[model samples]
Target: MLKRVERPVLKDIKDACVLMKDAAFPAPFDSRLEFSCSARGFWNIVHTGMLIPEIHQVYVCAQGCLRGVVLTAAEMNAIDRFSNIIIRENNILEGNNEDLIVEGMGEILSKLPYTPKAVLVYTSCIHHFIGCDLNLVYRRLREKYPDIEFTDCYMNPIMRKSGVTPDQLMRKQLYSLLDKQELDKKSVNIIGNNFATDDSSELVKIIRENGFTLREVPRTKTYKEYKDMGKAAINITYNPVAIEGGIYLENKLNQKHLYLPLSYGFDEIEKNLDILCENLGVQKIDFTENKKMATEAIINAKNIIGNTPIAIDYTLTIRPASLAKLLLQHGFNVVSLYVDSFIADEEDDVKWLKENYPDIKVYSTMHVKMRFVDRHSEQKILALGQKAAYFTGSNNFVNVVESGGMYGFDGIVKLCDLMIDAFLNEKDAKKLIQYKGLGCENYDTNCK
Candidate 1:
């Protein structure tokens, strides 16, 4: 036999990133086997779907698929609102797959202590393989329980290879229960947010003070209130994942749509806020005081942290490129960006980084090569997100994901404060980043 060939595990910092100028949009790295980073900072479909009040989830998948979601509900202490129907091999051979879903749902509902306003019927990849008639399943369920509405959701991991991501699809499906409502011209609902926008943020303050009602899912107390989202005069989406859902509601309900993603850059913040003010027919916000406060906070953090090599990741803020630019402009030594792909909204920011800071490297979060990279290092690196903290071996890191709903000038100030605190403090990075869906309290005993 020929000599056995051995593939060497990658071990270099330079290998982790590309020069910013060479980075590509959507997909920067060539397709190959992927290595998953253990930073489950972003919320999954289960966490998102549960945001709706008085809604139940019934996952019709193999037991293996059910484990992850079941644990999520258990951890949140909401197992009472959750149910499942295990899809066995016999169902694929002799048993009717559609009937399993229709009948299983009926059994689940009849057992519940109280009737849910709606049910999220989730199917797995096995359903797709068997060519299950989902429309038939939904029709039968609707006919059987005319009072209880049904929304179709997915748990298919196979879809990861292509098309709209499960995250995007689940977000769109969240608003499926909303029906036509008499318009509320003074009311606005921020769509597809797992967290409410900060009360102190310019957007919230301006909207509330300007005689406009802002509705957020996290603040909705009842099922009727959640349905009233359809009556909003404006639909605002700041999260990139929620953009599709916002546009969906805009067209279907004839509400004005605004997608102002949380930005650290002052100019972008101003431009977005100005647009919002114009649409809502409110006076323009004065950001002079806000900008001054944010600038002071950044200066204070920079002085404390000095030129410590800073790393940013997409998990914290979807626009890592923009946040990196903000730090660089404020005189921070940003070393690498942990990004899998660039979002469409950050095109200009990407180009700016490419032209001005070519040496600022871009790294793929899921590249197979990342698995072999040395994680333990002596150097003190400051990581801006959980993924960056894990990959950089930085105990000193700001651990916020999805920017922690920090928005506008107040957001920038809050970011600086977090950075300062992170720099001054050291925590066990390994233990901290391992928790899935940060900001939500998880219980080991499930509130027994």
Candidate 2:
């Protein structure tokens, strides 16, 4: 049985509030778990590098470590581009694995019908533990294939505690092949997620109005196009994980960048837009129509939802606190939050929620104790995010795989529409959780 813990409202949390890394509740609730969310997998980050058309990847790790990504690649139909160098126990002890990686990559490249312009040698956590010299292997591969560029991409989970996480390091490594080029002041690069920003996003409009060409890694088809992304004068990063890469480009290539953390709150989104317009020196576009539509949609959903407790799960979003703030602002009774840790920028939202909506209890899907969460809330609640639906036992739930291309005011409108649909239609929660990709919860199965 799961027991809820009680704590003071945000104002009473402390006279001088200090941001704590762990959950507000103590013990098992605060302890983190490895419970995997069906919402995402390891390959989400892997494909960010491998999806490049002209690039081949060599994943050098143990067979056990290789299985998940191998299965995922096959599932995604991207198996043809991957070759693995499985490390054995003996190899780790003996420590001369550079030859294996270099030889394996060479053989894979030789057999390929289409010659690759670049090869990424991805090493796992075991290599770091054994202190395997991947740099040497990368250098050897570069020497062997002078025409093909080789980069050292790491999958080392051990270094995750470092200020720059493995994902952050990997995003930075994606731009390693980009050499300094003549700047294109009229061009802008969105260096971040594999997902494309919503075409209706204000950010997209601002870029176009300024007459700047937009470039994103996922949208690039050829090696030349990928390389040309470096030519952009500005980089606007949506996710914080990609901020390090933006900084690297700025310092190394003299490319200026603006880091806009993803936010679900309308106010925060508008504020981000203001900063974006100011940074790009573009006229701020009006979002009144979008705002009006979103407000109307929210009202319609709220009329049907009434006072039903809504649980917003963190797995469905990169910014759960911001989303919760948005929901609360719309007169929704957000009674439960399922989140693990808060990012630095989320502190303000967290504090505000504590101060204002203190009745909302916080839960952790990643908590080790969640294994014992058998009791569902008595309230006939509506859940947002797949994990929230799972834990809360809510029939009326919004199931989303990530943000589902949701951004800006347009996203808010779509979200309200989804909420209304969930309330009216009783979709099987099990089937919805199993479904993947953008708008997976919707009737349309063709969405990628």
Off by over 4 Å in 1: 1-9, 12-16, 443-448
Minimal lDDT window, size 10, model 1:
439-448
lDDT of 2 at 71: 62
Clashing residue pairs in candidate 2 (N, C-alpha, C atoms within 3 angstroms): 10-354, 10-355
lDDT per residue for candidate 2 within 1-448, as digits (tens), equals: 9989853223232211223233352221433335554544222445667646588777889998888767655555566777888888788677668777877787788899888888887888887777777678777877889999988888777776667888888889888888899998889988866566776777787888778899877667788988998899989887877899999999989999888778876677888888988878777767777778878888888998887888887666777788888778878888777776666667788877877876666766654445445536676778887878877677778867557656788778788889888877766776656643333123122112
Cα misplacement distance, residue 275 of candidate 2 (Å):
2.1
Q: Specify the highest-TM-score model's number.
A: 1
How many Å off is the CA of 75 in candidate 1? 2.3
lDDT on C-alpha atoms for all candidate structures: 0.85, 0.73
Instruction: List the pairs of residues colliding in candidate 1.
Output: none
